[model samples]
Target: MTNNQPSPDGILRLINGYWATGIVSASATHSVFTHLENGADTAADVAIRAGISERGAQTLLDGLVSVGLVGLRDGRYRNTAEASAYLVEGTPASLSSFAKLKLTHMNALADLPEVVRTGGPVKQVATEVADNPHWAEVVPAIAAQSVPAATIAADVLRLPEAGAISILDVGGGSGIYSAVWLEANPDARSTQLDWEPINAIARRLLEERGVADRFTCIDGDFHTTDFGTGQYDVALYSHIAHQEGPEGNVEVFTRLRKALKPGGALVVCDYVVDDDRSGPAFPLLFASEMLLKSKQGGTWRRADYHDWLIKAGFEDVSFHSAPPATLVVARQRRRPVL
Candidate 1:
């Protein structure tokens, strides 16, 4: 005989999800992964380097081992491959900052029930308010997450071969796309439009990457700012669409269409859901974060994007997969031959 009843194991794990979050966050905050990568094999070594008690370091190491982010053998600890690649402090794809950022965002989950009931965030942190301090911290952390997707987008567009191209990055947080594209095509120049505080952060990051010479910033709200006419060869709206409603997105797309030169491409990298509102897991789950943080934001469908792009005077709209996100590329229609 077999039981038909569902097991409580899944429910238990869901409720205890914060345990995993806390472990990762604490480990990142204490630089456990970095220390491990730097030859700290014992908890004592890690504790010495991280300035924590040996017992505490041991417990944290055990927690990390349990989560498969760290490995333990012969009573010694080491960062797992994934941890070394992404959790180390200065790796090209480091996510240490992103993990630490989540520790701050985790507090907002407590208000989910109220937010759902009220149909909006109780107090929005993901918006443009003059000198919004949240952007200063969150922007750089998210830039790491965008690196892979930005590289993919740049490759797909053959940015390296597209010499002397002009790029317009709308609401370009942290300026990762610009950095990647500029690095790929040394002759390319990119402009970013965003809040002044966020632009300040982007300037510092681009300066560090040595791409500041090719990058410029327009410090203002994108909604009110003029994108200018027929100016750019490529335009990017990376990771900003989900924080807006349909009308807002359509309006922005219209402006971006005008901002592009004839036949210019606009690349929108975002967590786009399926037409039927089914799951690719992460994007579907990310909708909850948008709901908890934004007044009118959610993972939109591909169909929604197609409709908006078409309505906004774009042609050849298509989608491409860049895991954990999607790229919706649309082109401004070219003029007819005489």
Candidate 2:
């Protein structure tokens, strides 16, 4: 655990990492964080209120406290600020549903050995598109995790309050980012493109924020949809590019660029690998998760994005730091007609 030293072996960490993951998962699974936030401060209170055995309650509480995710004060347990900020229920920052979604993803790992042998995921990641309606919960939960990042992205774009400025949110699930941008730029309008169910979710978010009047909701896939040429002043690819491979991304980037008025920005925020691709950990593991989840999706390199953006006739590319992922900002090349 030396700072600046290489971590222990990969296999060792992967084997035991689930211990901590399970701890957080169990606490969230049993609504321990929610109960603590709602005033079930002691193990007995949590046990009684949550309908679990006192011994089981205490075990879970102690495990979370040991991991610094929970704090103890005067014999009462409390969620640490980090846990309250990101793990509690009924909050935009809450990732509780994301945790549950990943828990379901974990169910597929039992077939990993065969997946490796076969060179494809034996089990694909589940979706609302499946018979289950659970994605109705998961997509918004995933979007909540992106709100802060997307807010920063909007800040980077520095849009103005002009009705002439039009933006496109490609695969904008919850419309959090577009809603944020529209909030900032009252006169500007956006078109949110995604699937039918996801667009329904986005419409609700926009309506709740009172910005639905200014934003258009279109239900379709970005790959197949016709994003009108020279119509958009800005285009956002928020967390959606990670689902596309290099060539697929190039095609989408080309379409997004074609949609943008020359000099308009194309903003991409997604889990990406550094050029070395050695570690930053989450993105690397997310790459593997993508393999299991999609027929063709994985984290890619910064160079890959840079090249693809350029190939799509984009220029003035710049990188900006954001948490967990970086923003690749580029512009459609401004060329005069001959």
Candidate 3:
């Protein structure tokens, strides 16, 4: 009975908020947001466009409207501003398809309890595109959403005055960062490393973006392959570091450091928790996904990244915020003289 008072069980309400994610996933899978992209439409029109029963579509749209992902006016529906910007299929920021793909992995959600008990990716992630054809299909959309990620990396690259440059993009899906960089710096060339199918997607995207001539595709397991030391001026590990644990991340940067010229930069993009690990809902939810899927990965603190950067022989380490993510930049220290 302390003065804090029995306001509401806000935390429990949030925990129960898992239902909202399910609803969003359902609407996305049904293409509700895509249909709403052009303008508001009656539920019947939406159902026809999306090929769902109008009755069922109405239920889904109502749920979306209730959740503020869609808006209703005069018995017609439209995407909410946030949903239009980020959930519509053709929009540059569309992540609804990604959300739908993740929902297909709902089996992973079932293993959350086991992950908490054992810790680590409960199963090896299916790296083969055959095992998951969705990876290729989603790559373009994910790359499209990653413009901000690529832009931030380019900004970091602009800070230094390096001559002819070669960048190695590790796990670089769709060559998004390299594509953006190449567009900005005609002198820059890149090698995009990812699984074959993802690399194929990257190649297509690079070509469409008109930078394929300046890029190379490397297909292999980064964990097992030699990334080649002293070859690249920049190495990027965008949106993938948090998929591996601290030691795993350290191993990655260590290899990249070996691969870098003396002053090479490593740009990492991921959702980062504040050092306090208190809030910031996005990274926290991303951490929850890691909890279900990864044996070692979770959203990490900026301080933790700094420690790993130092241990990996990176000297000028710092963090910067971009929308929906934080970019970690670290430069390989000059090779120590004996």
Give per-model TM-scores.
Answer: 0.94, 0.87, 0.85
* TM-score computed on alpha carbons, candidate 1: 0.94
- lDDT values, one for every candidate: 0.91, 0.82, 0.81
RMSD of 2: 3.6
Clashing residue pairs for model 1: none
Any runs in candidate 2 off by more than 4 Å, and if so which? 1-13, 124-134, 160-164, 333-338
Report clashes for each candidate as comma-separated counts: 0, 0, 4
Q: Residue 119 in model 2: shift from native, Å?
A: 2.8
lDDT of 2: 0.82
Off by over 4 Å in 3: 1-18, 73-76, 121-124, 127-134, 137-141, 159-164, 332-338
**Number of the top lDDT candidate:** 1
Query: By the TM-score metric, which is better: model 1 or model 3?
Result: 1
For model 3, how does the per-residue alpha-carbon lDDT over 22-72 read when each residue is reduced to its tens digit? 778888888788888865388788788889898988888877887898887
Lowest summed lDDT window (length 10), candidate 2: 123-132
lDDT of model 1 at position 188: 98
Off by over 4 Å in 1: 1-6, 124-126
CA lDDT, candidate 2, residue 222: 77
